[model samples]
Target: MSIQIGDTIPEVTLKHIHDGVRVIDTPTVFSGKNVVMFAVPGAFTPTCSEHHLPGFVARFDDFRSRGVDVVCIAVNDPFVLQAWGESVGVPPGLQMLADGNADFVRALGLEMDASAYGMGTRARRFALYAEDGVVRHLFVEAPGEFKVSSADNVLAHLD
Candidate 1:
């Protein structure tokens, strides 16, 4: 089963490009913060590049105003994530995280095999809200769909 409301976020190392591929842990990112994290199967894929990430980038301030930290995770390398973020104009506060090994997604039980597309294991498109590391809301999209996990949708559900 995937992570659910009221479950604590799993501890796993994730990467980002900040002065060169910095390492961060889930606990350090989610603890003591109201976080809104969205995951994409892979970076630079059409929907993720054009819609999913851009939606969050456009609404970064909205989330910040509501005291929520926005993060974008993809099962790609830190370099790809950094380039994608720059290409899409990701704001400073909205993190672009790299889950290169799918460890984080596996821990959440949200890993999906995309071997048919030659992508191997990747995260299902999902967005979750957490406060102090405990999940409050989770929006997981059906395969080949994009709706519930959109930034606007997630923001609407935020308190």
Candidate 2:
């Protein structure tokens, strides 16, 4: 079953590129913090690159002011994620987490098969509000749709 509101995030290791080095086994990066984690189907896709990420980037200050740390996730390798982040000018405080192997996506039960598009396994577009690693609110989009999980929507929820 897909993860729902009130579900505690599973403990999983996510890869990230930090200071030109590959970091592994990092834990509790978001623990004990108010977090807004949004997942996209893939990195560098049109919707994600153009709309989803930029929305979060634009609203970073607002989210931080509301006591929320924002992060974006995708089912791509760390290098690709890092390149994408740099290409789009990701802000310093916003993290782009890589679920490259889809372990984290599977754990959340939010994995989607997009092999028809040659995308292989990917994450369903969604946004979640978490406190201390437990979900407090969730907004998952229907396939091919992008409404409820937009930055604006998440912002309204934070209000």
Candidate 3:
């Protein structure tokens, strides 16, 4: 089953590419924080690169002022995620996380099989507002759609 509001986000490990590959624990990072996490189909895809991730980067301040940490997740490797972050100039408070093994996305029941597109396993586009470790709101976009998971939509709910 997909994660729902009021559920505690499961503990999963994510990678952050920095001075080297760093392993980040999901529960440790999200616990005790008001978090806004959005997932994309893949790094550098047209829709994800052009609109989805950029929306969050552009609205970084909007989410910060409200005391929320915004993050982006993709099924790509950490190296690719790091390159994408640098290429896009991801601002502070907007994190770029790599679910390289698709473990976390699969746990949420949000995994997408994109082998037809030669993308292998990927994450469906989605976003969530979580308080501490419990999900307060969830938005999973329909396949090929990009409405609910956009930054504007997530920020509007925070207002």
Candidate 4:
């Protein structure tokens, strides 16, 4: 079954780009913290490039003002996310993590098959509000659609 409210954030090792590839320990990342995490199908895609990640970047401090950590994840490698972050000018502290192998996305039951597009498995567009590792809210979009998974929508759940 998919993750739900009250479910602990799953444990998975993800990657982040700093000077180089860095390990992101999922469990420790969420431990003792309130976190807002969003995922995209891939990095550098049109909608995600124009809307999703930028929304989070714009609202990064707002989420932090409310005492939450903001994170973005995609199926692309850490290198790709690194370039995307720099291109978008994502402010420091909003982590952009790589679920390159789809392990964490699949663990959340949020993986999608993009093999038809020659993209292999990717993460669906989704967002979640979590505290101390337990999910408080989740917004998962339908395939190829953008609705409740946007930063504005996820921020609404914070209220």
Candidate topping lDDT: 1
The number of clashing residue pairs in each candidate reads 0, 0, 0, 0
* Model 4: residues with Cα > 4 Å off, grouped in runs: none
By lDDT, is 2 or 3 better?
Answer: 3
Question: What lDDT score goes with residue 30 in model 4?
Answer: 96
Instruction: Residues 1-159, candidate 4: write the lDDT tens digits.
Output: 778888988899999977888997898789999999999998889999999999999988889999999999999999999999999999989899999999999999989999999999999899999999999999999888998999999998789
Which digits, one per residue and each the tens of the lDDT, describe model 3 over residues 2-102? 89999999999999976899999998779999999999999989999999999999998989989999889999999998899888889855789999999
Worst 10 residues of 2 by lDDT: 21-30
User: What is the lDDT for 50 in model 4?
Assistant: 97
TM-score of predicted model 4? 0.97
Q: Candidate 2 residues 1-159, lDDT tens each?
A: 988888888888888888774654424666789999999999899999999999999889999999899988999988998899998889998988898889998999999999999999999999999988889889999999999999999999988
Tens-place lDDT per residue, model 1, 1-159, is 889999999999999999987999999999999999999998989999999999998889999999999999989999999999999988888899999999999999999999999999999999999999999999999999999999999999985
Best candidate, TM-score: 1
Regions more than 4 Å wrong, model 2: 24-27
